[model samples]
Target: MAIEYLGLSQINGPLVVLEGVQNAAFDEIVEMTVNGNEHRLGRVIEIYNNKAIIQVYEGTEGMALRNTHTRLTGHPMEIGVSESMLGRTFNGIGIPIDGLGDIDADKMLDVNGKPLNPVTREYPRNYIRTGLSAIDGLTTLIRGQKLPIFSGNGLPHDQLAAQIVQQASLGDDTDEKFAIVFAAMGVKYDVADFFRRTFEESGVSDHVAMFINLANDPVVERLITPKVALTLAEYLAFERGMHILVILTDMTSFAEAMREVSSSKGEIPSRKGFPGYLYSELATIYERAGIVKGSKGSVTQIPILTMPNDDITHPIPDLTGYITEGQIVLDRLLQGQSVYPPINVLPSLSRLMKDGIGKGFTREDHQDVANQLFSCYAKVGDARALASVIGEDELSPIDKKYLEFGQAFEHQFVGQDLQENRTILETLNIGWKLLGMLPRKELDRIDTKILDQYYQPADRD
Candidate 1:
C-alpha cells in the first residue's frame, strides 16, 4: 500500500521538499498532483531522516505549497527501451518528439545504470574508421574505446561530429550491425535542427537516434539526457547485440547544468562552481563504454567537449583527460589555416591504436605510417617558428623542404571535403604520398624493412 501526503514543506526552483516522509528511498520516483487536476513526475534526489528533496521533471511554477499531494513510486527513474529507438528522436527524458509516436518498448531499464565490472571487459583489438585522415591515420579510434574530442567554442566541432556519424564504419567487410546514438543537452533549437537535417541529407538517419534538450527546457531535464541515452544504448548493445557508437556533444553544458542544480540545492561548490562529485559523475558515464565478455556487441563513445577559452587545464576537460583513453584536440591555429578537421596530431593520440592496427586488423604498415606522419608534422612547427625569426629565404635547403611539406600537410591531409569519406587504406596511402616529399634519411620513425617495401625515394620527384 502507498500513502499519499498533502502539502509540500518548501518549493525551491525545481526542487520540492516533502517533510515527515516514511520509507522514501534515494532516486525513487514520485508523483505529484496539483489542485487534483494536473499531474507531474519527479525523483528523489536527496533523502534524510524523515524528509526528501525531489527534483521535478516538470518545473513547479503553479503548484502552491498547500495545494500539492505527493506520493513515492518506490522506484528509481526508468525509461521504456526498445530496438525501435534507432532512427527516432526524443526529448531529454526519452519522450518522442519526431511525430513518429512512442516506441513499442520491449523492456524498461533504469536510467541510472550499474557500473560495468572490470573482470568482464574484453580488450579492444579492432578499429572504427571515421574517414578523416587526421583521426583515421593517426589517432585511430578503436572499438570499445572512450576517446573524447577536446574542442573550443565556435570551432566547428559540431561539423566534425556530424561527419564522423555519416562516415564511420567497422572496415571494408564486416557482417555486423552498427548504429549511432547522439545526445545533445542545453542546445539551441537551430543547432538541434542542424544535426537532424545533416543526418537526413546524408541518408544516414536510419541508424541514428537523437536525444536533444533545448536551452529553453527545464534545467533539470538537461541532467537526464545522457543517462536516458546510455540506458537505451545498453539495451541495444547488450541485449539486441548491435555495435553502438554514442556521441555526446558539449558535455560542458551538462557540467554547467550540474553546477546550477547544485547551487539550487545549496551544496558546496568545487572547481568552477561545479559540485565536488563531478569526477565520479563523469566516470559513471565514460566508464559505460566498453566490450563485455559474453556479449557479441560493444559500446564506443566519442564525447565532444569544448574547453573554456581553449584551456586544457579547465576542470571539465582536465577531469575528462584523466578518465578517457585519449583525446583528439582541435586546434584553433589549424582551423584558422582552413583545416577542416583541425586535429593537432602532436597533442592527439589513441593509446589503443597499436593493438587495433597491424597485419591482421588494418595493415602491415599502419603503425610506421602513423609514427612518421606525427614526426614530420611536429618538425613542420619548428620550421615555421624558425622562419618567423629569420626569414624563409635564409633557411637551409632541408628547412625549405619542410616548409613546403607543412603547407601540403595542412591543406591535403588535415583538410577534407564535408562529403568526403576516405577508406583506411586510402588514408594510409595519403600518408605515404606526403612522407615521400621528404628525404629517405629524414624518415627515422619507419623500420628499414617497411622503408624498403613502401618508401620510394624517387616518388618525391
Candidate 2:
C-alpha cells in the first residue's frame, strides 16, 4: 500500500501539513479521517523532506490536527471515460452534476493525461465554420487549433460562445463528425441556465457535454475545472477518434481562482496579485489541444476571457496572447452600434488561417480577397480619423469614399445576427459587395484579373 495514516502537525489555510512518509506524488489523492467519524479527501500538492502539504478537497474546517489521520491513495483523482459522458453535466472533479447517478464505466483515466508527442503531432488544417463572417472571413478557425477570444465587460462573450456551440460544424453529415465540451468557470446561475436552454432548444445536447464551476463554488474547484474538461476531451478525441471542440468561458475567473489558491498557500504573487506561475499554468491547459498523429480525431480550443477594464495589456490577456495561436477581439464600440458579435476585424487574427484557407481548403481567391478587404478597411480607418478632425468636406473624394467604406464594412461585415451562419462563398460575396462601393481606380491591392471575376457592378441593385 502506498498510503500511511498520520496526524496533521499544522493547518495553513486550506493546506494541512502532515508528518508522514514521503511516498505521495504531486496531485495524489489522500483521505483524512477527521474527528474519528468524519472523513475528508485531499490532494498532495507539495512535499518537503518527510512532510507533505495536502490541499483538502472539501476545505479544512472543524478538524483538530492531533485527532486527524492522513492516508495517501497511491493514484491521483480520476474520471471514467466513455460514450456515456456525452450530453452529461459534470462538476470540477468530473462527478455527475446533472442530477444523474454516478457513471459506471469499465475504465477510469487520470485527469492530468500526458501531452501529445511532437513527432506524432498532426497538422491542423481543416476549417470549423462558425457562420460568423468576422471569424470566418477575418480570422478563420482551423480544426485542432487553440484560438482564444478576448472580450471586455458587457461584451457578450457568453453569447458568442453559445452561438459557436450551437452552430459549429466540421462539414455535412456524411463527412463531418464533431462534438462540443463546454466548461464555464465562475459564471452565475442565470448564465449557466441560459447555456442549458440554448443547448436544449438547439437540439445539440446529445453531442455537447458541459462541466460548470459556478462563482459561488469553492475557489480551489475552479482550478480543476479546465483540466477535467480537457481530460474528457482527450478521451473523446484521441481515444474515440472524434473531433472535439473545447470551449472554456471566462478563463480570467480561472486565473483568479489560481491566485486565490496561491494566496492560501502563501505563495508569491505576480501582476495584479495573481500567481507568478500563471503563464505556465495556462500553457498546461492550452497545449493540450491539437491533432495527434495516427488518430482521426482532433481537439480544438476556444478559451474566452474578459479583459479587466478592457485592458488587453493586463497580465491575463497579455499572457494568453503569447501562449495561444491567435485571438478574436470583441469591440465595445461595435457593441454600442448594436452589432451582434462586435468582433473588431482589424485586431483579430488567426495565425493558422493560411493553412486552412486555399484552393484545396476554401477557395483560390480567398487569400487575395481577405487581404484586399483588410487593406481597404485600414485605409478607411485612416480616412475616418482624418475626417473627424478635418471634416468630411475638407477631405478629397477618394478619402471620402474610404470613410463610407468603413461605415459599410462594420455594418455589413462585422454586424450579423447570432443565429445566422453564412457559407464561405456567401461571406466572400458580402465582402465584394462592400468593396464595390469604392471606385475601380482605388482597387490597387487586388489583382485586376481576380477583380474582374469577383467585383460586383457598383450600379447593380
Candidate 3:
C-alpha cells in the first residue's frame, strides 16, 4: 500500500508541497481531497529527503495548506487507449469532451512513453506530401522526421496546419493508412472552432483525433495536452501499424506553462527567466517521434510555434530549431500581401529532404529544380533590394528579369489556395515553368541532361 500525506505544508499556484513524505516516487499520480470529499488529480514532480512537491492538474485555488489530503497512487499518469480513439475529441488530459462515452480502452498506456532505441531506429526516408508547393517541392516533410512550422503573431499557421491535415498523405495507395493527432494549446475559442469546422467540412474529421486546451483552461493543463496527443499517436503508430502525424500548435503556450510551474516551485531560472532544463524538457516530447526497427509504422511530428515579435532568437523558436529536423518559416511580409499559406521557401528547409526525394521517391529532377529555384529567388531578393536603392529603370536587364521572376514565383508557387492539393508531379512541372523565366546560363544547379530535357524558355514553352 502507498503512503498518504495529510496537511500539505504549502499550496503555491498549481503546486502543493507536502512534508514527512516517505517512499514517494517521482511522477507518481496523487489523489488530493479537501473539505471531506472534494477531489483533484496531481503528480509528484519533486521529492528529496522527506519533502515532496506535487503539481496539481486542476489547480490549487481554494485548497488550504493544512486541510488537503494527498494519496500517492504509485503509478505515473496514464491515458487509456483503444482503436476507437480515431474521430474522437478529447480535452488536454485525454478525457472525451465531444459528448461521447469513455473509450472502450484496449489498454492503458503511460503518457511518459518509452524512448525508441537508438540502435534500432531507422533513418527517415520516403516523402509525406503536404500537397503544398512550398513544402512538397522545396522543404519536403519526411516520415519519421520532426519538422516544425515557425510562424508569427498574425500569420496563418493554423490554416496551414488544417490544410496539411486534410491533404497530407504517404504518396500512393500502398501506404494510405494515415492518421492525424491534432493538439492545440492556449488557443482562443474561435480559433479552436475554426479548426473543428475545417476538419469536419473537409470530411477528414473521421480520420483525425483532436486534443484541445483552450486559453481559459487552467494553465497547468497546457503542459499535458501534447503528451496526451503523442501518447495516442504512439499507440496508433507502433501498436496498430498506422502512420501517425502529430501536429502540436502554439508550443509557446506549453513553454510558458513550464515557466509558470518552475517559478511556482522556486526553481532557478535560465535564459529569459525560463527554466534551465527547457531544452531537455522539450526533448522528452519531440524525441518521441520516429520509426523503430521492427515496427511497421512511423510517427512524424509538426510542432508549430509563433516567434515572439518575429524574433527567431526567442527561446521558444530557437530551442525548437535545435531540437527538430528543420523548420518551415512563414513570412509576415508575405502574409501582408494577402497570400494564403505564404511560405518563404528561401529560409525554410527540411534537413531530411535529400533522403525523401529523387528516383523512386518524388522525381529525379526534384533536387535540381528546388536548388535552381532557390538560386533564382535569392537573386530576385537582391534585385528588389537594389531596385529600392537605385530606380528599377537603372537596373541591369538581367536584374529586371529577376524581379519579374520573383513576383511570378510568389504568385504561382509560394501562394496557393487553402484547399489546393497538388501532387508532386504537378508541383515539379510548375517549378519547370517558373524556372523557364531564367536564362539557361543561370541554371547551373541542374544537370545538363535535366536542363536539356525539361528547360523550356517562356517563348519556347
Candidate 4:
C-alpha cells in the first residue's frame, strides 16, 4: 500500500512540499498526477516532523496544488541494470534514449548505494595508459585511483576526456574487456554529439556506455547523471568481471545543480554559495571507484571539472583535490600556444605515479626520468623569467641551454598529436632524447648508472 496526498502546501522550483505526511522516507520515489492523467516523478529529499520535501525529476512546470496527487512508492529511487547496457545510450535518469528498448535488467540498484568498505579495498598498483605523453610520461593515471582533470572554460577538457576513452588501456594487452562509462552533466548538444561520434569513429563505441544530461534538461536531472553512470559501472566491473573506466565530464555542472537544489530548499550556503555538505556529497560519487579485494575487475575514475576563471583554489577543485589521489591541471597559457591537451606539468601531479611505474610496470628509469624532467623544467622556468628582465643574449651559457631545453621539451615531448598513441618505451625514449639537449651535469636527478645507459648526448652538428 502507498500513502497518497491530495494537495501540496508549496511547489518551489523543482521541489514540492507536502504537510502532515506520515511514514514517508527520505529518497522514496513519488508519483505526482497532474491534470488528471499526466505523471511526474520525484524523490523525497528531506523530512521534518510531518512535512516531506520532494525533488521532482521531471520538473514541476505544470504542477497544481489543488488537483495534483502525490503518492509515495515507499522505496528509494533505483536504476535497472543489465549486461546489455554496453553500446547503449541513456538519459540522465537511466532511461534508454538510443531508440533501444529497455534493458532486460539483471538487477535494480539504489543510485545512492553504499561505497566499498575501506578494509576491502586493494591498493591500486597498475598503470592505465591514456596514450598522451603529457599524462603518461609525467602525471601517470593509476588503475583504481581517482585522478581528476582540472581545466577552465573554453579549454579542451572534453577532447582530452574523449581521447582517453578512445585510447586508455591496461598495461597488459591481454587484460579483460576494458569498458568506459561516460556521463556528461549539463553539456551542450554539440558537446554530447562530439563524444558519440568520437566513440563511433574510433570503433570503441561497442565498449562504451553513455549517460547524457543536456543544458536544457531539468536541473535536478543533472544531480542524478553521474550517480546513474557510476551505478552502471559498478554492475559491469564487479558483477561481469570487466575492467571499467568511468569518466564524468564537467562535474562543475553537477555541483551547480546541487547548489541550485539547496538554494531552492532554503538551505544555508557555505563556500561560494554551495551547500555545506558539498564535500561529502562529491565523495559519494568519486569514492565509488576502486578495486575490491579478491575481485578480478577494477573501476578507475577520471573526473574532469572546469575551474571557474581558471582558479585552482575554487571550491569545486579545492575540495576535489582533497578527495582524489591527484589532479591533471590544464593551462590556458598552453592553450593559447595551440597545445592540444594543454596539461601544465608544473601543477599537475599523480601521487600514485610512484606506485604504478618502475620495475615490471613501466620502466626502471621511469621515476628518475620523471624527476629529472621536473627539475630541468623548473630551471627552464627560472631562465625564461630571467631572460624577460635581461635579454636572452645577456644570459649565461647554461641558462641559454635551459631555454633551448624548455622549447624542445614542450614541442617534442609535451606537444603530441591528439590521435597519436605512443608506447611507454617510445614515450621514455622521447624524454631521454629531450634531456640529451643539455650537458650531462643537468641530469643530476637521474641515477648515474641509469643516465649512463639512457642519456647519451645528441651529436650537435
Arrange candidates by lDDT, descending: 1, 3, 4, 2
Q: Report the lDDT of model 2 for residue 364.
A: 76
After TM-score superposition, what is the CA distance of residue 12 in candidate 4 from its true location, in Å? Answer: 0.4
Poorest 10 consecutive residues by lDDT, candidate 3? 169-178
Q: lDDT, candidate 2, residue 155?
A: 89
> Which is superior by TM-score, 2 or 4?
4
Candidate 1 lDDT: 0.91
Question: If both were scored by lDDT, which would come out higher, candidate 1 or candidate 3?
Answer: 1
Report the C-alpha lDDT of model 1 over 1-461, residue by residue, as the tens digit. Answer: 99999999999999999999999998899999999899988989998899999998877879889999999889999899988899999999999999999899998899998778899999987999898988988999999999999999989999999999999988789999899999998888999999999999999999999999999988888888899999988888888888999999879999998898899999999998999999998999999899999998889999999999999999999999999999999999989988888888899989899989989898899999999988888898899999999999999999998998889888888888999999988888888888888999999999999999898753545
Measured against the true structure, the TM-scores of the candidates, in listed sequence, are 0.97, 0.95, 0.97, 0.97
Instruction: Estimate, for each residue in 62-157, the C-alpha lDDT of model 2 and write its tens digit.
Output: 877788888888889777877788888887677788888877765788878886678899889878889888898889999989999999988899
Q: Name the lDDT value of residue 166 in candidate 1.
A: 94
Question: How many collisions per candidate?
Answer: 0, 0, 0, 0
lDDT for each of the candidates?
0.91, 0.87, 0.91, 0.91
Q: Which residue pairs show collisions in model 2?
A: none
Candidate 1's displacement at residue 349, Å, is: 1.1
Question: Which residue pairs in model 4 clash with each other?
Answer: none
Off by more than 4 A, model 1: 35-37, 458-461
TM-score result, candidate 1: 0.97
Tell me the tens digit of each residue's lDDT in model 4 across 270-316: 99999999999999999998999878888899999999998999999
> Which candidate tops lDDT?
1
